[model samples]
Target: MPVVREFTLPDLGEGLTGAEIIRWLVEVGEVVAVDQPVVEVETAKASVEVPCPYGGVVTARFGAVGEEVPVGAPLVTVAVAASEGDDDAGGSGNVLVGYGTAGHSAAPRRRRVRPVQTRPAAVPAPQPTAQPAPRPARSGPLPVISPLVRRTARELGVDLATVSGSGPDGLILRADVTRAAAAVVSRETSAAAPEPAVAWDDDVVPLRGLRRTVAEKLSRSRREIPDATCWVDADATGLLALKDQLAARAAAPRIGLLPLLARICTAALARHPDLNASVVTEPDGTPTGIRRHRAVHLGFAAQTERGLMVPVVRDAQLLTTEQLAAEMARLTEAARTGSLTPAELTGGTFTLNNYGVFGVDGSTPIINHPEAAMLGVGRIAAKPWVHDGELAVRQVTQLSFTFDHRVCDGGTAGGFLRFVADCVENPGELLRYL
Candidate 1:
């Protein structure tokens, strides 16, 4: 008899507790290799493909796509040949990407597994727009794998044995149950007097996946953090002039406006180390004490099709303007292509949000939680400004700084913003800290 081994969702690390199933890579009754990616999941940080350490015939999958599964919850159950596993259901000591195992199991040889037939069972149905096809009558163990699916079927009075499965290998999915329930309603409605349809669900958007994560985090930031915003208008003429002069030089690495500002922000953080820290909070979210960081892990906000992502540049205080430009470019590309790792998306001690790319003047955006502050840069445009005691049209930009009031008072926050503004106006002053 093949030993049925369950594979749980391994911890993806970086303080993540659960992940939303983005898509299923393998189907029921498919033969899988050791360490083969079985599913793609999106955590609070990034989307990661989870591989199974045990190779065998996949008997069942636990969660539906778009459903959140907690860490340690079963993801799939594989029927491994007794010979393939050393002891009981012979398990592999093989490790997995985006997850970790305690230790390797010795003498676990990679072997091919032929798909096995699943014991049949029934599941109830639920309401769905698409109709599910009919399945021949079968009786056995429940065909449903996920407990949540079973719950839905029970609540909706769906009969698992009667309902047809639209999932892989006749596995009854939650949607199939939902569709069954919907069909029952439709039939019942036809028996009654015809009423006009409301189309109530047309405009309703579900807060799920990335959008849900973003919403929860932003809500926490607002609820927990005592934040204050401060802004300043600076003459960016000197900054633009400096960029042009540097580009004119040989092998200057194609300087950009954001990198230069990033350099300035790092210099300012170095001067005021107080801003480069996170507040240690209690279980009740009480601010206990301030914890200072030695290195500056700067995060820049990048908007992707998925949602807003902050890709962190490790040790931004150490990167030169050109180096910062290159790293920022790399991270930006990764963010846009949705290839960023969770490590790259987290542990940001401070954030730089260049909303200027969106053609906005200024915004007092919410501070990214746990981080002390975020510097927002707006569009740089030619505007009427003073240059050396003379009124002239100069490139001007609005820089806004939002900080956690628990870490520092208004005076410290104002000073940090002032230093950044001075660097923008005088460009050469940025060299003193460099």
Candidate 2:
């Protein structure tokens, strides 16, 4: 008798209820060792590869790629135990390495109630000589475009079918809709005729994946947490010069402003520990006060192929600027290629979002969950300002900080921002503190 065991999907941590299957590395009839990677799953924040927990011959796979599987659902099964003295009877032919134990009893399998398939009544076969009728001409309302475009067209009172499309395969775009509206205006003016204004048709967009997660998180953050935003303009001339000098130096490691920003934030947290804390409420409807953290795990908001992901640099306060830069680069590359592990995406004590790369001036970024504050860096631009009692051109950047008012006081937040600004303005000062 052979005993089989089924391995179910384990919680990848962070209380995630489910994940989308990205790929399956194992197949049926293949022997696998414990801790061997078997499947890749994509959560809202990141994609993670999961290792098998049992050693045995793979008997079945429960989920397909791109399908979402709930936590504790059976993912794969293996035959681990066999009758004694059955080695010559095709029992346990090969033992998997790294798996010390065997012959574990399998859990009771859950039977899914699949819908019964019924044979459909056979239809009379069509004659071979019968010709198919041509499709009816698209009339009346001009075969309305997509619901989104149709709503825009109706709101502008422009006929979509008459509008020329510049999109691929002659599909209408938002720009085409705007142009059609303008053309209608011009034609009505020339003909001295009045056109009736049309109202927009109701439209809907399905929320899924990152967009859906973003919506839910943001809504909860806004409704539950009281947020306050503070803005400051900083002189980045010194920072730019330092970056260029470092890039040109042979001994200095190549780096960007992001790593420098992370270092500054880590240092600032030491002074204003309140901003480094989170507000947690008790289950009995009582609000427990601020909780400050000791470790500085800085989360860097990275834009990836699937969506936005934040991978943390653990204990950034202890790392040298060079080490921080190298780690940031490695983690960023891993995020872009979907190779980041689950551990890398968790335990962030603070977050830094670089909107400067996108040429944005400033934005109030939402704090990553459980972190009280987040900082946004804007584009550095040359502008005229009064310096040393004289008008001079200097590189200036905008800083936006959003914090949970429940945890961080306005004064503490202001001081923290000023500290970061000081670090950016005086690069040499960082070395002294370090």
Candidate 3:
């Protein structure tokens, strides 16, 4: 006899409530060891491998690949072999998504025995008049974490209690609430005159994984934050010369314009710490205050096959230009391969977006939500500029700064932007801070 233990999905971090199963690493009836990865799931943050805490034969799996599983939802059941002297079969002492090994114990496995049937006289069937009993209500907290989902439900006057959840463990998802609201609207519309049907030929690409997350985040940023952009065209000839000088050193690594800009941004942020923070909002989404961070956890925009990802370089204020270049290169590779973890993709105090690679001159970048500001750099091109009181061809680039209005006044924002432009136009200005 073997005791079966059930495992549920665990919270992956960053307030994420659920994950979509990408693929199953283990199948039913397969033997698994403790802490072995059983499935790969894609959360809004990143794609991650979920490990099992129990070591045994997998007896049952709860969700199929492509299905969304909420935190605390049963993922798989494992049957452990009964051991001598112990009344219950024990699980491997492992900690993962849900269960841990502390004071671990197993319950008795209940076996269902089939009843034997014997030949008997013909029996008549009863009339089917009795009504079926209603299904029991599920107990525990509703499977929902996003404040946006709750707000949408409240605005639509949808009763969350009445609607059933399709997510793991009967968790109520935004889709579930949306469907219920649509049903109500449909009934009301049917009561009045029906509208004419339109031809439908457009293809719907189901937004999933990272793409869906990015869409929701950008939408929320637009809806909630009052943001403003300030830009300036700077002469980058000095910055290019500085880069060339650094690259000429025997010990120096290849230097790009981004690392130089990143170093300038960090220095600028130190001078104006207000731009290196996030606004603390009240429950109703009102800005109560701003929380300024001391250390700079810098994030840079990286384009990948999955989609656009901003990988944060932790303790960026402490890293040198060469180190920043190396870290950025590493993260870019991770992003391209979809190997970045949630921790790597999040916790960014400020973001620096370099859209110059796309050959754009300037763009009013949307501030990455929760962060106070973002710095956008455009392509550096040779243009006629005033040098030594004469017009000459010089390297010129545009810098755009977007900031949350609630965080600081325009004057502080302007000062920060001006500092960065000064450093860009004269790389020597950064040496004082260095």
Candidate 4:
């Protein structure tokens, strides 16, 4: 006798609830080893490979690629051979998020086909044409793994089991449920022979995955945080010169304008620690006090194909210009490649956004939730500016600072922005802070 055990999706940590299946590495009836990566899933944070903790023949898979599966939901079922005198089904002694390793009763076994039992019966005359038996009806969970799909079906009053799935191995997707619902509406309209004057679902884009997370956080930030934005037109001539000088050096690491701006932001934060803190909330979600941070974990926004993401650079205040440039480059590459982990995507006391890359002059971007401030830099171009009491062509840029008004008064925010602007106008001013 073989014992079948169901494996549920494990938590991927960092408070993630679910993940979208990117690819399935295993197929039904295939032999698998303990701790083998069965599926690659893309969470809001990163793409991760999920391993199965059971070693046996895979009997069934619940979700298809592109379907989201919640934590603790059934992922796959494996059939393990029962050892003699052992009643328990063995599990692999491998530990992953949401589950721990456990002892097994028997060693691993190879996969084999089960023998069919035969019974003697009286033979009957065969018909000239034999028709094949109908396919067995699928039941028990509807092959739908996503809760979103189930909820959509229920809200639209669609029978999930009756609709054929277009996904791999007949797994029901959200689109399938929606199409079934649309068919029902079509039939209803055909009976009435009428047309409506409005389209509700047209041009509607779903907010899911990273976009959904960003929307919720931004909405909360706008609703709760009293934000104020201040802008300054600064002469970035010196900063560009400084970057050129560093790049012209023999051994100095090639520096960009962002590293210099990052340095300036850190210096300003150090001077005005009030803007570097987040508000601490009580149990009921009311602001109780401010929790000032001693170190700066800086987050910088990077635009990727998925959407906008903020990747944090830890202990940014302590790193040099070269080091900051290196870390920023590394994080930007990871963000572009969708390889950043959840840890790298969150937990920042401040954010630095360089919207200049997009050729925009300035923007009042919403503050990243739980963070106190965000510094935005716009494109630096040659503009007429006052230099040495005379109008001259200078490399000018727009800098905007959006801060939580509750964290500090306008004087503090103004002073911080002024200091950053001064640093941009005179790159030598950073030496005083150093």
| lDDT digits (tens) for residues 380-423 of candidate 2 | 99999777799999999999889998886788889888888888
Per-residue lDDT over 1-434 for candidate 4, one digit per residue giving the tens place of the 0 to 100 score: 56666666665678887888888898777888888988878887777777777877777676656677776666777666665114443366453554333233132222212222231122112223222332332776466546688887898898877877655345567878877888788676666764653433444466667788889999989988999999999999999999999989979777888888889989999999998899998766689999999999999989999889999999999999899999999999998988888889888999999999999999999999899999999999999998999999998999999999989989999999999999999989999998
Model 3's TM-score against the true structure:
0.73
Candidate 2: global Cα-lDDT?
0.70
What lDDT does model 1 reach? 0.80
- Report, for all candidates in order, the number of backbone clashes: 18, 0, 0, 0
Which has the greatest lDDT? 1
Question: What is the alpha-carbon lDDT for the whole of candidate 3?
Answer: 0.78
Give the C-alpha miss distance for residue 284 in model 3, angstroms: 1.2
- Clashes, model 1: 18
TM-score of each: 0.78, 0.68, 0.73, 0.81
Backbone clash pairs in model 4 (N, Cα, C under 3 Å; residues 3+ apart or in different chains), count? 0
What's the true lDDT of residue 217 in model 1? 78
Candidate 1's C-alpha runs over 4 A off are 1-7, 26-34, 54-63, 72-83, 88-98, 101-198, 249-252
Residues 62-168 of candidate 3 have per-residue lDDT tens digits of 55566666666667777765451143433444544333332252422222121222311221122232323323226555555445457768987997777776643
Off by over 4 Å in 4: 1-6, 29-34, 54-57, 78-146, 154-173, 185-203, 283-285
Alpha carbon lDDT at 92, candidate 1: 52
